[model samples]
Target chain A: MAVASARSRGRLEHPRRLWVVGVIIVAAIGFLLAKGLGSSINYFETVNQAVALRSSLGTTTFRMEGVVVRGTVHQTSRGTDFSMRSHGVTVPVVNTSSPPQLFAPGRAVVVVGHFARGTDKFLSNEIMVKHSANYVAAHPNRVKPGANGSS
Target chain B: MIITRRQARRPLTSSSSRRPGSLVRTATGVVGLASVAATVWLGLWVTPPSTNLGQLVRLLYIHPPVAWVAYLAFGVTAAASLLYLWRRTRSVVWDRLAAASGEVGVLFCGLTLVSGSIWGKATWGVWWTWDARLTSTALLFVLYLGYLALRRVPSDPGTRAKRSAVAAILAFADVPISYLSVYWWKTLHQTGTVLNPQRQVHVHGLMAWTLLLGFCAFTLVYAWLVAHRYAVEALAERQQGEGLARALAERRAEGRAA
Candidate 1:
């Protein structure tokens, strides 16, 4: 009935109306998607960059990757405090929960959190340790509750 | 009575036992099975654990390709939609293709999300995050799901096609955002190591081969599924059309009797 409908609906008519209306609705949605991104987008920054622009960064959360500095970690039942360093710049990170198994010092880690206003301290809600591809158990005690180091 | 008459006249309306393309269907099933088998074998057995992620990196072979196909399916939908809207190319076939691709896209999109969540839980110590990549991907999944739902709403074929075309185009706006989320925002997700010029290829040797194989297998599987799903969509459309014709014919006979 495609042919039937086309004939009855007058296939000869111009389709300017449809084209115009579609463009308007689509454009409005696109605009909203773009505009709302500011609140949602969290940029990744290095420790050096985070500190250099701590005043400008304000309350916007971000992720920063660096190697944990040895002897700068303190663990507690309530939370853990550590410092991450890269290229001579070190950023102190305070996490609210037990760090992942590989979160020890001198290992590469990514901290997901934000810096307090006017403070150099980086407060992290989550910390992701860089795991190496070698199927070796770096620490038998620290491996995730159910995961093993072997295939 | 109308259904009986219709079914008798069109025995193949939805029957697959004696489909015209039985050989092709068999071939597709074989290929699909082979792809899945090979992907699992290589991804699990052949490839070494990732250099940094160890066993958790196994998800890479599956996650990336599943996401790739999800994106590919939606991209095909967007292209088909564009063709459907163009006056010179407007046709029910294009609409059918768009509908088929959108459905497949949603399926793969769901798989991608699940696989990604598992990978995240293994590596990131969490199952889900509101990071840009994940959040934008979730949005893409919902948008396409909405597109599928819209297709189900009662409407004439012409209106359905017109609305779906616009919806597909609108939904595709999220694909790029989801893809570029890592670069565009600060997120827990890692940037694309393969495609990004700034990053070097992280996997080498058998790992690279296995990853490549995973991508090829999934793509072939997607093609096979799309071929099957499109045929199903066409059959459903035919049944609807036949039902309408039957109703019209019944009304005409009543008018003559009156």
Candidate 2:
């Protein structure tokens, strides 16, 4: 009977107990990773925060995020200039590079730049448009009629 | 999905045609190969270039689908792992399914990161950034790597299943965070263009059509891949059982006689 029992095969020994321990450890690690995300958020400031800290932010390079004020975008030989606002505070940004196609009025953006405390302007090295995953028309009339082809 | 004790006794051999599900596996292989060829054609030649990125927009056809399937595969793995935890349904089948999905998810996850880098370099003039989305995506890839590694450690089948199931569940926590990283924080990465229904659609016209087809094609390929992988795992398990049986018979014969 002992030999017969030895021949029988089944699950590995101690799986159930080890699994419980693994679950605890994994959950703890996941929680730590989530908490770490707070400290590692991308932008250093919002538009309002940047303005409020303009004096201290003097010439210090940083990335700031804000919504582009509508109709404030302009094309210039230097590149592009726009106004971004948040929480009733607005900052003028001059980006010395062509903006992405998504960079337009009434969109959210992050600008990598330094504060020109004397001129009260943000001199941007790069401009990035931020939006959700939802697709919007890249432009009106881009799609022809009868495009409701969801299958 | 059922494997009887008798079936387990038989080892995997060249005579696989005698195996119960070998026919379906062969058919799946053919379909999967054909779909991949079609995808390559649509992605390279058929899709139009973007107004801005030009030829680089062709990445749109394959990138999104690869990313989507990676997410889908991980999601399935987590679900299967959870099922394996249930007392009534606790079995190695669910564990093997989870592992198969994990392997495929990692393949596509790597593809997604590479394709994304190529597209970014074309448009952003940069190959990489430590932005919120990019970092979270990299984290996701690492988590999957850890999960795969955990599966390979020497252990009894039951213990391995339990550990891997837990790894699958934990690794999946990153998937949602990676997807929502763009919306949750400001980053150099572009917002979600294809999935946001509440906002205006960025991709329009024939691009949208090709993207939809891309998803369909990749999803079908994933299903076929998983099916075949499961069959292979079953064959391997059968072989292991036969090897053990042979060792046991030899030991018994040694003690009993000349």
Candidate 3:
């Protein structure tokens, strides 16, 4: 009779134990979500998503990636303005300060800045010109290149 | 096992009469308090300001060390989780340790984010960015949060432990990746400044020594947090046992009355 009672009690406490465990997990997730949401969106996005979401982005700062259109790069006294092309769509980029020396035609570029409302222009604060596969192959010291690189 | 009514009502220590356990508890408490005190004092006031940022640079002393401690706690969680999974018999203890460490780790990680942001707002024109170090650290914070959440989803203890252990192990991968992502990627976040001995020698005088002392103090505080957390978990388990025993005894008495 004592053995049966002990077994029953153990069984009863089992659910409570699980409940406490669940609470701890929820607390952890809540903590992370709270922090993550406080920070801005800085995660990876393909050119397609950037284009599709272009309308709603407004003037908020963001990052976008595309290939530099061959004939669209024009350097002014202020800085350089160029058009980035991806998936047959083009967005004008105005860089107001120092552009990377590597910025040029047909290069993959990631511009960190903002998109103006009602226009296809992106005002960039920083520009990163993606290195090609040959740059990685020629330089053995470099690790994996961009997202498209393999071997 | 259901405790007898007599044992349930017994004085806490009378049932156990464990001297070594009490000694361990006292030692853990003392060490924990001392560590926290030392870390706070040395990290904040004792450290001198940087020439460039002046007083604002003091934020760096608190922020980086807290970040390091968080990583250390997560490492403990991963190792303990692995042990629990490997030897399933004594896993409850290990799982408790993992959970404790995860909580403290998350707390320190929060501190890191706060202090880092405060420093950034003072130094840089912006609050945050997609820089490799920042992004990876943020991901790490998220991954551990998810790991903790996995422990809670299931009602079965055995199933929860299994799943939590797996999550802990998998999330450990993010730590190294977070540390090294800056080296691999072209990131705005400056590469690690303190770890390399050669670079350490070159840093402007007071800043280097302050950081060194900060690391030491933070490590001790981390040890203290883990120890205290483990003890709290043990005490909670005992209280839980008592609650169950009391419930069983009341049920028995009601049956007799009926």
Candidate 4:
């Protein structure tokens, strides 16, 4: 009976336990390797915190966040600059880089850049806009009246 | 009557075998407590705050370790569930391990999410994003929750174990994908760093060692929790087996009386 029990356990341990252990070991090694090598990975932050610490922010090296203020966007030779309002503060953003498609009025956006000395302006390196939870319509204005030769 | 004579002789054998469990519990508990406390202390106090983020960097103490422990627990559940299914023996012992690991893993996973969000808010200025890694980790959490629910289904033990084993295996697959999603695609979630010895060593001396200790401490706590939960499972299984045996015996007596 002891031999029988041992045999059964041996059979059971083969595919399930051993296979999983193998996978975990391989994946862990891969993960460690990637981390061992220098990788640029940034964590997300919010607008309120960014605005509160604007004075101390390093020039062009930190990230900032706020809602895109209505009619604040202006196209420049390099890219665009806009006033983003968050937590009742207006953050002036200078985007020398292209913005994400979703950037517009009332939309929350995060900008990675550095605050310029004396000007308190943020020179952005990257821009990411947050989309709302509701599924966006495939056509932004499906009911455009007579705009596309429609009745 | 024949079986009773044999069983009476086995009582002494069973009594002598009870020490291993208590010994294991004590050892695991001590190690787990020490490691986790040490990690938390060193991580929060010893590590130099990020040049950029200052004390808000303390969020690293909980986020990475909690994430790692969640992975470890899911691996434990997958292995145990597979073994139970393959053995075809209704060992409630293994099931208990699966259930405990899944629940604790979920708890840690949730903590990782919360701590990560706080860290992000402090660093990036947004609470959440639909990044690849974040989405996958959330899915992984939901999958494990589903695995736990499968165990509670009213069915024969063998059938339930077999059914849950498949889900456990899928959860294991998700672990790697969740970890790698950032690297393989455009993701807002940062790739790993603390576990990489090379990178960790290069980090400012105080911060590196503190985070390392924190990882070790969380691992110990995880092991202790698993062992404690496993013991409770063993006791419950024993009670269940005894109840079934008594029911069977009573039914036999009723037939004889009839």
Decide which is better by TM-score, 2 or 4.
2
The residue-by-residue lDDT of candidate 1 on B1-258, one tens digit each, is 457776786867456546658667667678767877887998787675543565666787789889999999999999999999999999888998999989999999999999988887778777876678887887788788778766754556798899989999999999998888877776667777455546566566676667777788888788878887888888877766776687778889999999
Question: Between the candidate structures 1 and 2, which one is better when assessed by TM-score?
Answer: 1
Once superposed on the true structure, which residue ranges of model 1 sit more than 4 Å away at CA? A2-36, A55-65, A102-108, A112-120, A130-151, B1-22, B197-200, B256-258
Q: lDDT by residue for model 2 over B6-106, one digit each (tens)?
A: 78756654477656576766676677667667767866886665544446567777888899899999999999999998889998889889989998898
Total clashes for model 1: 9
DockQ score for model 4, please? 0.03
What's the CA RMSD of model 3 in angstroms? 11.9
lDDT by residue for model 3 (B211-239), tens: 66667667766776776787787776676
Q: How many clashing residue pairs, candidate 4?
A: 18
lDDT of 4 by residue, A1-151 (tens): 1111112223324556555654664565455434323222333345566656766654537555567887889999999889877677776888888675445566666677777777757788677654221111123345632122100
User: What tens-digit string does per-residue lDDT give for candidate 3 at A74-120?
Assistant: 98877889988777778888888666544557767677888777777
Q: In candidate 1, which residue pairs clash? A: A42-B186, A43-B186, A44-B186, A131-B52, A132-B51, A132-B52, A133-B50, A133-B51, A133-B52
Error of 3 at B90 (Å): 4.2
Candidates 3 and 4 compared: the better one by TM-score is 3
Query: Scored by CA lDDT, what does every candidate get?
Result: 0.74, 0.73, 0.65, 0.65
TM-score (C-alpha, index-matched) for candidate 1: 0.77
- Each model's Cα RMSD: 7.3, 8.1, 11.9, 17.1
Assess every candidate by TM-score. 0.77, 0.71, 0.59, 0.58
Put down candidate 1 lDDT per residue, A1-151, tens digits, no spaces: 4532322222212356444544554564465456337434643577888778778778778778787887988986669998898778998888897787545667767788898766778888888765433332223355453243211
